[model samples]
Target: MFWDLLVLVFYFIIVFYFGFHFAKTNQKEEDFYLAKKEIHWFFLLLSLVATETSSLTFLSIPSLSFKGDYRFLEIALGYLIGRTIVALYLLPSYFSGNTISVYEYVGNRFGKSPQKTLSLVFTVSRLLGDGIRLYVSSLPIAFLLERMGLNLSPEILGMIALTILSIVTIIYSVVGGFRAIVFTDVLQWFIYIFGGIFALGLLVDKLDISIWEGIKNLQTSQKLNLFVFDYLPSGDNSYFILFALIGGAFISIGSHGTDLMLVQRVIATKNLASGQKILIGSGIVVLVQFILFLCIGSLLYLFYSGQTMAPDKVFSQFIVAEVPSPLLGILVAAILASAMSTLSSTINSLSLTWARDWGMDRWFSPRTLSLFFGLTLFISSLVPYFLIQTWEKGILEMGLTIFSYTLGPSIAVFFLAKGKAELPVSGLVFSVFFLTSILSTVAIGLGFQISFTLLIPIGFGIQIFLVQISRLAFKKN
Candidate 1:
């Protein structure tokens, strides 16, 4: 335990160093928010992956494969397809002018009202979705401390964990700005990826199983199954391959193309080519990372045959109970690294959106606004620790599902703007209401049980259809 604490402390010191080091370079608002458009493709690529992957990816994804199969890879493939389309269609527009926030494009195409409205939506959605992510990130820490004989309740431990994460993230993000976030993200990405690979190797060694033998066993058990061609509207989240593919594509579009958190990183790159590389390259890295963790989960199943646990808790439990001391600490730090990477990005992005879109920067410095949003996210992160017990789904799915509620309307608004149409504020409101209403009525009120996978595409279609109808109605008037 002492050794583990030491390693964790060392990691944070390095993160703080980078944060302050980068802060020395901040000369203006653009430098602070966009890194002065000086980030290279490689670092931006890694930052994109790190930003997209929270502790959910680090901990929950392995649990997913441990409890189920590898069918989620289909979604990763869909991510690749979606990213390609974004590179071809979306990246050019973001780079076409001196755009700071991607919502600036909306203002140019629609109006200031829509741009600010969309920014507000992005801020709210990010708060809710990443709040769940922050909670999920605390689980491993809570489990670890509990195993070390801490006498606290899970809720107490979770809150403590979240507080620590928030403080570290806020300090760096406020001081270091975007450059600090991106560069540190690159470092965190390597640490967690190495941790995943090391854990798998350790598991394989402990089980006395050869790689091929484990693969053979997993294959025989159908645990390694990668594709599902069925279309059951009410089936499990992993079974509907077609919907998963389409849904994955739409989610990627909403997340990578429309979300300011991600688009900020893309536009920070030197040129259109660099931005394209960041988008497409991140998809590939994410796919590979997902496969690596899924394989680790499969190996874990072989190691713990006949044991039953909650899918989300399985990986963390193994780390606490099974792994040896210092290595255990390293893995825990890796989890912290993953969580902090996403949290820092969220804080920075939320601050940028608030300042840039709402004109808050004129009243307050960007650093001050960053601290403000960081605190807001920290408070929001605590909400989930109390509420997550009532949720029936895994953290990853729940977080993604929450984003679906707003991402569809967001993407539709962007697409509408691309067509140079003036979208009314009422039309934007109606789009969100209509899509969310249909989603709830069909899936909850009527109990037809549509898969969460289909929500984004369905929502996007609804928004587009509504916008077209509004356009036609305006023409007739």
Candidate 2:
């Protein structure tokens, strides 16, 4: 326990020291939020990976692999393909103007109301979705530590972890801004990826199986198959394959293309070409990272088949139970680093969105912006206190599902904005309000899942038809 605390303290010190070091001198809003838009490609690529990957993958991907096999790669492929499309079409437009918030592009292309509405949606979705995500990501560690006589309450343990993470992340984000976040994220990515690979090698040794044999076993178990139509839910119906493909694509666009957290790296780039490169380079990095983690997950399940009670804990438990104390310390550091890297990105992104889109700079005085930021973070953190849960998912699918809501409304906003067609503000509001209500209620309450094919068509159909009707009515008059 003493050793774990020592390592955790040292790791956090490095983060705070760097954050304060960067922000020690004069501080400005642009420097604080956008890092003065002077980031390099390599660092931006790393930040992109860190922002998108999150700490959840560290624990969850291996758990998924333990349950099945390479089937998870299908989701990775979807994101890779989807991001490539975004790199070509969407990124250039974001660069076209010195846009601060990506959703602002939606407003410029659409109108004020749509932009503001989507910004609000992004904030709500991320805090609820990613807040729960952050909570769940730390649960595996808390569970394993408790079992080892570290004996902390899960809620208490989670809070302690979140507090450390928030402080370390906030220091750099609030001070050094995007540049600090990206540079640190690049450093942390290597720690996370390398630590995961090391754990994977250790797991394979314990399994008494070569990695190739494990692959063969997983293939024979049908965990390797990407297309699973065996049990179709009502919404997916007969079009399961098509649904998987389309839904994956839409979810990816909503996440990588529209979400501000993911786009911050692009916005920080020196030029449009650099931004495009960051998107493509980061997309490839994510693909490789997903494969590495998924393979580790497979190895984890194979080794610990009957020994562990919960499969979710297999990956982190191996680090806690089997790895030597010093190495264990390093693993914990890596996990916290991963978590802090992502949380910092989230806070900075949320702050930027609020400050810019909400007109905080103009509407509020300097003192008010400071107060608003603190208040917003305080309110956002309250989410995990009430709603964190322990459900598990594969790294890719888990991210996309959380991403759907964040991306969905923004997609509608951007599509309208880029189309530059006059959309009825009333109709736009009604369409977003209705779609959000139905999707949230059905998906959460009734447990109904609609495939992307149906959801996208319906969501866009309503918005477009309303706009067209308004146009015709005006002409007729």
Candidate 3:
């Protein structure tokens, strides 16, 4: 336990050093938000992957595979397809513009009101979604402390872990700016990957099974099954392959193309070509990373002989009960790395949107705004502590569902701007209301059933239909 704590302390020290090391370089808004557009494609690729996938990927994805099958990979394939579309259609507009905020394109195309409105949507959605991620990241740490015989409530333990995570992440993000976040993300990407590989190795060794034997075991149990061609409207694991593919593609486009959290990294690249490489390459990397963790879960399921456990708790439980000392600390650090990477990116992007899109720069420096949003997000992270206990779905699914509510309207607005459609504030409000209602189970209350996968495209279609009606009305008037 002592050695494990020592390793954890050492890891924290290294991360802090990097943060302070880059603190000297942040002299302007660009440096603070976009890394001065100086980031390399390789580092940006790593940062992109690390930022988009939070602790949800690190901790929850394995649990997802353990409880279910690898059919989720179909969504990843959809991600690749979606990113390819963004690379071809979206990157050209983002690259053509010189502004740091991607929503600046919205303002240039439409008006200031929509830009600010969309920025608010991004901020609120990220706060809710990544806030849950920050909380989820601390779960394993809380569990680790409990296993070490700490007598505390889960609430207290979660608070302790979250406070540490927020303080450490905010200090670097505020001081070192975007450069620090990206560089640390590069290091963290490798650490968590190594941790996943190490955990799989330990699981195989302890199970006294060869890799080939484990594969056979998984195959015989049908845990290796990766595709479901049937269409089901609602059931456990009721994902239809066709809907999954289309939904996955639209979600990816919305997330990577429209969200500033990712587009910021893309535009920071050296050129259009580099941006394209980073965007598409990150999708591919995400696919491989998902496969790796899912394999780990499969191996773990074989090791445990399919004993039922809470899906989210399975991987963390293994780490605490089964992993040896120093390596346990390393794995914990890896989890922290994943959580911090995403949080730091969220805070930075949120601050950037505040300063650039919302015009907060008129009142405060970007640095001050960065710190402010960091603290705001820290508070928001606590919200999930109350909500998570009652959640019935896997953490990964819950996070995805929360974000899906906003993705459709957000992406639809982008298409509106791109088409030069003139939409009023009421039009935007109606779009949000319509999308949120239909995409949610609330639509069932209205006697309609909408699959989650179809939400984004449907929302996008709705926006287009409304815009056309509004245009025709203006013409008649």
Candidate 4:
């Protein structure tokens, strides 16, 4: 136990070393976020990959394959399409202004009222989505603590886990700023990817099955099924190929094109060409990443001999029971790497969004910006304590589903801001925003039968449709 923890401590030590070492001192807001400095495109590509990938990708992708198949890649396919579209359209707006918050582009195009409105919606959605991610990362940590004979309730374990993860993430983020976040991001990305490969190799040695034999077994069990060609929404978050492709595309566009945390890295690149490269490249990188982790899930299913368990629990239990010490600590560190990279990004992004969008920067220094959001994030991370078990979906799905509510409307508005037509804004902004929120409430909260994948596309469509109608209404009047 001691040796395992030591490995984790050493990893964090390196993270801190790089964080403060590269962190800009006497920094203004531009230096703190993504202004004035030139980061290489490769680092920007990896930073984009690391920030959005989160614990949900690390743990949930494998869990998806363990229970189902490679159908999740259908979403990846949509991601590629979505990103290509963003590179073509939305990114021009991102670069057109010296926009601090990406929403500033909206303020430039529409009005400040519209800008702050969308930013507020993003904050609520981001906190809730990232809160679930914090919970997912804690699953393994809670499992590890239990293995070490910590006789605590799951909620208490969650709190302990949240505290440990948030503190380390907050300090470097607050002290080092975005530069530190990106540098550590490159490091964390390598660590977690190695961790995935390590687990895959371990499974290979243990299974002791021929590649041909394993492939045959996978075929027989339908575990290699990659496409779901259904026509209608299954109402259960099931991915029909079309639903997956379309919904995934919209989700990617909304997330990568509109969300500040994901898009900022792309915008910080050296030029428009570099921005497009990283944005599109990240989608491809993430698709490959999904394949790697999903394959791990397949191997795990074989290792466990097809026993049914909760998707989230399957991998966590395996890490606790089978993984040896020091190695065990390293694996835990890998999970922390995924979780912390994102939490750090969240605190910084939240700080940027709040300070820039809502006029908070006038009253708050850059460090104070990080400090406030970091504390808010720490408290938010514990929200899933008792409620986690009540979730019907895996952590990854839940995280995406929650964000789709607002992400859909957000991307829709971005395009609306870009269009040639002048739309009526007096009530249109709140109209689409509240309508999407209420629809999400009714669908998921009341257990309606819409594919979670379709939430973004559906919401985006609804908002765009309404804005057009409002535009026509003004012309008629």
User: Relative to the unseen true structure, what is the C-alpha lDDT of residue 398 in candidate 1, on a scale of 0 to 100?
Assistant: 51
lDDT of 3 at 344: 92
lDDT of 4: 0.81
Residue-wise C-alpha lDDT for candidate 2, range 398-428, written one tens digit per residue: 4335444445545655666566456644636
Question: In candidate 1, which residue pairs get closer than 3 Å at backbone N, Cα or C atoms, i.e. clash?
Answer: none
- Every candidate's lDDT: 0.82, 0.67, 0.82, 0.81
Q: After superposition, how far is residue 317 of candidate 3 from its true place, in Å?
A: 0.7
lDDT (Cα, tens digit) per residue for candidate 3, span 88-147: 888888888788999899888766766887787788778878877887888877877777
Q: Rank the candidates by lDDT, best first.
A: 1, 3, 4, 2
Q: Which stretches of candidate 3 lie above 4 Å from their native place?
A: 233-238, 386-400, 420-449
Residue-by-residue lDDT tens digits, candidate 4, 252-320: 998899998988888887678899999899999999999999999998888888477788667777778
- In the order shown, the candidates' Cα RMSDs to the true structure are 2.6, 4.1, 2.7, 2.6
lDDT of 1 by residue, 57-138 (tens): 8887888789889998989998998899889997788888888999888877765777887787778778877877887788
lDDT for residue 197 in candidate 1, whole number 0-100: 91
Q: After the best TM-score superposition of candidate 3, give how far the Cα of residue 60 lies from its true spot, in angstroms.
A: 1.5
Worst 10 residues of 3 by lDDT: 437-446
